[model samples]
Target: MLEKVAWMNMLFDFYGVLLTERQKDFMDLYYCQNLSLGEIAGEFNVTRQAVYDTLKRAEQVLSQYEEKLGLVTKSTAERNKLATAAAMLEEYETVKSDGRVQQARKIIEEVLEM
Candidate 1:
């Protein structure tokens, strides 16, 4: 559940920048907080299906934004780069060579660029 919350937060943070306030609020309550459709409908004074439709539309919008912008892809790339850098750093710590240290530093810089 915590992992789901983290993923939803990342998605919302990336795409919510492109959404209206109401859309952001609806998504936060429905996805991040895991509110029921009926509960969200009651809060918004709408029918359950209306709430579901709003969520579906919001998801479509988020998918479109990710498809166009590649934010999530870029984020994943950067995370992988950082993980590689961390592994290099751990190896360097054990080996302790000037050349290996320099290579690890280069990897860290490349990860930072990503």
Candidate 2:
């Protein structure tokens, strides 16, 4: 459940503007504010089932957007590559005279530009 919220948070951060206001509102209340479905249902004057259904649909829409655009996937991949480059840069900083250190620096610069 925690992992689900974490993924939802990431997906929301990436593609929330594509969602409907109500969908965004429900999600923000449920995920960001840590409200239960019952809480959301009561606040919106709806059944718990309705809140659940809306959240499920919103999740599906977010997934579809990620599948088609792949912005989140690309962002994660680039972030991982950048992390690796940063670690290498840290290692290279200890031995600046190595020729590979300069190459590492160039790669880091390129990734940062991206």
Candidate 3:
């Protein structure tokens, strides 16, 4: 359940602008704000079932966007690779004070910052 929430939030961060305004609002309320469907419905003056349907559709759309674009997946892989490279560089730096390793580490830091 927690992993689902985390994944949804990450997807929302990556592709939320593609969603309709209503979809964005409901997703934000339900996932980011941790609001219940009933509470969201009350705020929007709609039924709980409507809220549920909108959320489901939004989830589907987000998943589809991820399937096609793979931005989240690619970003995760790149980040993991960069982290691994950084760790290896750090370990090498401890054993040998190499200028090239320090330069490579600096470049990795810059990439990670982006």
Top-scoring candidate (TM-score)? 3
Tens digits of per-residue lDDT, candidate 3, 4-33, equal 999999999999999999999999999999
lDDT of 1 by residue, 1-114 (tens): 777567667778887877877778789998878898899889989999987777778878887888898897798788887878777776777777577677767777676665
Regions more than 4 Å wrong, model 2: 97-114
Candidate 2 residue lDDT tens string, 3-75: 8999898899898988999899999999899999999999999999999999999999999999999998898
Worst 10 residues of 1 by lDDT: 105-114
Whole-model lDDT values for every prediction: 0.79, 0.89, 0.97
The CA-based lDDT of model 1 is what?
A: 0.79
Indicate the residue-level lDDT of 67 in model 2.
Answer: 92
Question: C-alpha displacement of 41 in model 1, angstroms?
Answer: 0.9
Error of 2 at 27 (Å): 0.7
Q: Per-residue lDDT for 31 in model 1?
A: 80
Q: Cα lDDT for residue 36, model 2? A: 94
Q: What stretches of model 1 exceed 4 Å from their correct place?
A: 1-8, 97-114
